[model samples]
Target: MMDALERVTGPANATPGAASSAIAPVLAGPPQPVRVLAAFPAAVYLEHATGLLAVVAADGVQHPNAVVLSVGVAARPLAGLHVGQEGTVGDGAIGVGQLQVTVARWFDPSPHLRATSPPLIAGKIADARAHLMARTGSDSHDLAVPADAVAEALRSGDMDGVLTAVRDLVGAGPGLTPAGDDVLAGLFAAVVTLSPAVAPEATTTLTRTLALTGGAVVDRARHVTTAVSAELLHHAVRGEVADLAAAVLHAFTGRRPLTPALDALLAVGATSGRDLAHGLITGAALVLATAEAGDPDRPATTVGAR
Candidate 1:
């Protein structure tokens, strides 16, 4: 649970408003955390004063339509707090608050939120972060793709070969690539040798490398690596400037830039192009689809008195 918050916070740090806006609506008002975890990628659980409302997203890649995950009749506020209040994020709990609760993927992969983890992912996340810091020459490592490896991987058809090589170098975090790893040394060299304007020249090489990596497993592996990277960025990106334009674009079109901070948090939040390609998948289940399982006119928005 703690790990998930830290992980997603990586990219969120770069784009504070975007991150804050994302969880704000869902945790609108206050109440006890009834459940946490995603059955789909772009899902949000809302615990308000009146009731427990599951926000059925309508974002294309994450939510094609609005659908509810679950609804609980709440006589009292969630997290034992007041209505219209937010929580302060902390180490153990999702955030320190007495209002609306925000549950993270780390706490509950299951819809039931029964299987709590031992925070082991925290260490793995730290290792990945340390690896990035050492190799990136700075806290951030975007634009530094291993061109030689990417070029070679492009020539080679073996996606596994590409990933194996990448794991060897950067040790995998955020948006790592097979070729990126094999030529990380060279990639860094290319960036350094070149002017600051072209420091991220490795990006072109990495894009080409992905074409060769091929298929589901490699793709999922990339996402997993991204999750790891996102966790590491928790320290690097937090409190930094966030890109609202980029975030909005991501929300509208399932694609995100190859940015380190963006990629890392996107993976952790499971909001990448790969994760929510349909704008209908939240963390685990398709709540929107489920909500409109039978009805055709899915209520787009609430008509409340302003």
Candidate 2:
């Protein structure tokens, strides 16, 4: 993406140069010429899946919603675009108001998945869980009961019970998005990966649940976020917990961590990280149990000190 941006800006013009003589400045004080390098018609959606304001073109190309032109906090150039405005973004003299895309300020959802000491990750998860339990009105128990039920249902290959358990848990917690939705996201991600037979009904139920609680705004956001999470969770279950760590991170921090994903999750809200961590752990455990129960001949994969 940087390479594409550089090609448009050119190497010599990467940094801000003097105002061009050809064009006059839009502002009164400084006569600066800002040239539009690249522009596209994009449907700006706050992807609740990863918490990014995805700017995808009609043809299905994703553009970087935020771009930094120079160094320091004052050099933010793309901060002035609006959701429904046809504006120019380019290399040249820019004013703060004209360039400010207030919505872009929220598009930092990427997961930081790095190789780390498994013990460190485990410890962080434990701390997150404890913190969540102590919070006022925390719904960990409310969420956990259905999770356990789902796991037990998966163990017995009881598809009916599994669907029922999942339905009971959907829209189960507080908040606009709800902790239950996050758990369902994690649980469904794992189930679809390990137990394909149950994926169809499980996904349908989850979609209905999201629609019921999310309303128009959240329902629209889920279109992107839920899909991205599912793919990441698939990658996670196939390998180590590290693979899905980004999925857990995206549930809270919005942006993926550049360091360890666990560190990102543990550093977030009063109980947001804790709740996501709980869902992730539960999803992973349920996947393992389902795999073991479904195929007794296949050796079970062990994770961490357990």
Candidate 3:
């Protein structure tokens, strides 16, 4: 059984005269002690023993696992905390060492991306790809080979190939969230979330295959990547993505404008955004191919060679 803390929700522990802060509802896990993983001026990440990660951010971007503070909470206060410091979640606040942030409310991260016409989704995907290509130059370190392998595997419904490509990506780059891991996360989120819409008849088979793949990805990630990235992968497998990534997905399905959301995602950490965008595009394209493969009258869609 999953622990209550994993559920990430319960009544806040209210304290007298304490002000509440807004948290991404997903981050408000049951009150429990946590240890600081990393600390920066803009954000502090806390890790639960169960391997869940939560972030306290002083910015407007509401990461899936973040507790967003109001403007009143300055970056200076977060600067005082250090990695390895102990903390607690209670009294409607997240206390890390001497820093305490109360929970005022929990906000939904984004509207769920609903099913839309495949032609519209395809056009948005093309637009997003063009935007990414125009804005970012080629990188010598790009994960094109492994990413394509994964997309091709998904396109052909080859579970073994998917796992092999995913293994290659688990720890393939540098950073807290390595570029390869980001790609995998984006791919996993897109496949799990969009497959049903794109290929309704194959949904059952795809879901079973993805459940197996997602479990293996999480298991492999625990051994190969940073704990923060591993935790994020775990959530991604379950179709929970960072708000920035979710925005791009929203656009891909035609619920919102593609360029603005794509630009916002592209502006994330040096290469993380672009890598994620690539993965999202690849996964969406694979969905189109899978749909075509299931329909005799439709021409097979070519999964991108890039």
Best by lDDT: 3
Maximum-TM-score candidate: 3
In the range 1-306, model 2's lDDT, one tens digit per residue, is 333222332124233322211111121122222333223333233322222222232222112222222233334333444434443323322322244221111112222334332233334445444454554345255677777776566545565566566666555556433566556555544443323322233234333332233233233334433433332232222321222344553332223432255445545445445555566656545444433434456554332112
Comparison by lDDT, 1 against 3, better one: 3
Query: Model 1 misses residue 116 by how many Å?
Result: 50
* Best-first order by lDDT: 3, 2, 1
What's the distance in Å from true for residue 113, model 2? 11
List the global CA lDDT of all models. 0.27, 0.38, 0.70
> Which 10 successive residues of model 1 have the least lDDT summed?
276-285
RMSD of each: 21.1, 12.7, 4.4
- Residue 158 C-alpha lDDT in model 3: 77
In candidate 3, which residue pairs get closer than 3 Å at backbone N, Cα or C atoms, i.e. clash?
8-29, 20-103, 20-104, 21-102, 21-103, 21-104
Tens digit per residue, CA lDDT, model 3, 92-157 = 457766666655555444336687766777787777777776888542235877887887776656
lDDT of prediction 3: 0.70
Q: Rank the candidates by TM-score, best first.
A: 3, 2, 1
Model 1 earns a TM-score of: 0.23
Provide TM-scores for the models.
Answer: 0.23, 0.41, 0.85
